[model samples]
Target: MLNIVLYEPEIPANTGNIGRTCVATNTRLHLIEPLGFRLDEKSLKRAGMDYWKDLNVQTYIDYNDFLERNPGAKIYMATTKAQKVYTEVEYEPDCYIMFGKESAGIPEEILVHHKDTCVRIPMMGEIRSLNLGNSVAVVLYEALRQNEFAGMNLEGHLHELNWE
Candidate 1:
């Protein structure tokens, strides 16, 4: 399944929403700290609601730890500076779709290090970027669509609806 990684995410609500997305899609959510808000913050818990317990979420202390643990996993940095469109890439089953904080995109060093894997969502006019939560959902669903929405076996999991 596709993995969602948020690097230094700022908003609790965005993280909460992404947690819900991960739960609904059966994807893994990996967060690289330090985060702006606590996971147990009222806003986050509220936005995530009951789905927080349903989400398969993981936390990493830093990027180096994530890299060391998941070697060879394709790390695609979503940025406005990239030349390739995200949809053009062949989405891998264990790929890491990484996003940065809401106010700024990923660091230049990481972008340059993973230049070939960098991708961007096309935009028009003066729009710089999409909301953090929305961007994760868009990229995640696209990858899931490419993979035919695997592991989404909702048939026997009727009890999930009662989660949130």
Candidate 2:
């Protein structure tokens, strides 16, 4: 299964939305430390609604801890500065897609270490960046597509849809 890592997320709603995506896609959600909002924030709860309980969310003290715990996994750093396009990379099931903070993005030190795997989503018309939640969704969908949309089944649970 794929892993979605967010480095120092600043918004509860974005994190919560990403959690929902992870739950639907059966991907593991890894959160790096120093989040702007608490896990129990109202905006997060509202955005994710009840699906938050079913989400497989993991927390890490920092990037180093995440690296230490999951060594050898290919980390694809998604950034605006990347020369390679996001779709060009051969994403693997063991790969982890890392997104930077909403305010400043991934630090240069970390970006430099994983320069070869760095990639950016395509944008046009002077758009500087995309919303964190939207960017996560886009990349997660792409990864899911590459993996044949694993764990997308919810056929019997249609009535349980939160529909937020």
Give every collision pair in model 1: none
lDDT values of the candidates? Answer: 0.89, 0.90
What is candidate 2's CA lDDT for residue 142? Answer: 85
Model 2, residue 45: C-alpha shift (Å): 1.2
Worst lDDT window (10 residues) for model 2?
151-160
Cα RMSD of all models vs. native, in order, equals 5.1, 4.6
Q: lDDT value for candidate 2?
A: 0.90
Backbone atom clashes (below 3 Å) for every candidate? 0, 0
lDDT of 1 by residue, 1-164 (tens): 78999998999999999998888887889989899999889998888889999988888898898888788888999999998998989888888999998999799988999889898999898898999998998889889989988867635533545555
| Candidate 2 lDDT over residue span 2-29, tens digit each | 9999999999999988988888788899
Best by lDDT: 2
